[model samples]
Target: MGRTVVVLGGGISGLAASYHLCRAPCPPKVVLVEGSERLGGWIRSVRGPDGAIFELGPRGIRPAGALGARTLLMGGDRSQTQHSFARPEPSAGASGHSVEDWRGCPRPLIPT
Candidate 1:
């Protein structure tokens, strides 16, 4: 048995946190909870029948280095799976931007 970690929400942060916890040398048991059936928080995507792609969420992630692979005992490595979203280039407009600017802020911050 190992330490148990309860993670609220199934958003990217929550999922990644749980993943890191499970990947630790002395991994803990992680339980992730999401209010709705869907996960990914602000990251979401869908493909049309004609093969057009539509993104309904925020953008991508860049691993500082090669991300560790996740595998299943019964199955195989999941790390090789193709990611649906890739980091997009910074756009001139925040509305057209796939992700927040590298400076850690979105463009055109509306004054509260």
Candidate 2:
């Protein structure tokens, strides 16, 4: 049997990793594990009864660059997410993370 790449979180990073891995020419098995029932980790949005939208956590898409953004935007099931990968959350422009932040973030899932 082929080796499986077990992704520990189902957040954007995890999902993105899975996406790229699946897209590879010799793609291996991928298993994503998220602690919470939802996939987006702390990135959440809640709609009020009066029809207001609120985002509670990391709220934007900061692509590494143009090509990276294009690669992510290019192919996918647009129907389900409604172009979510490219769309930043409400008030996203005000605050967000940089590529360096993402790179420096610790991988809580991988064992030492």
Candidate 3:
């Protein structure tokens, strides 16, 4: 008989855990127990006026231990997505600034 793995909750972490476990060399019988009727606790999507789909939840992620594909990072104008809360990044070559070019500190620290 194969091993039976019981996963609690249906959140992102729980879902990911069950998925990876099921894909292992010796796959196990995964039993996901979600308290709520629906899975994907916070991974819900909303349709915009133009039919564009958008998901809400965690803002950023770092693939330190896993290949993080969460958070929809929209560069450039945010109006298209109706996310006015996000400000656009500086245009490339507009400021003629480069990370390598350290133009000194802010107003206070600079010598007049």
What RMSD value applies to candidate 1?
A: 10.7
TM-score of each: 0.56, 0.54, 0.53
Q: Ranking by lDDT, best first?
A: 2, 1, 3
The TM-score measured for candidate 3 stands at 0.53
Query: Pairs clashing in candidate 2?
Result: none
For model 1, the stretches where C-alpha displacement exceeds 4 angstroms are 51-53, 61-77, 81-90, 94-112
Rank by TM-score, highest first. 1, 2, 3
lDDT of 3 by residue, 1-112 (tens): 7799999999877887887788789999999999998787788755666665555654333444324332233222234433323223452335665422324522212111
Worst 10 residues of 1 by lDDT: 68-77
> Over the stretch 54-73, how does candidate 1's per-residue lDDT look in tens digits?
56775433334334233222
Each model's total of backbone clashes:
0, 0, 0
Task: Point out where model 3 deviates above 4 Å.
Answer: 65-112
Using TM-score as the yardstick, the better of models 2 and 3 is 2
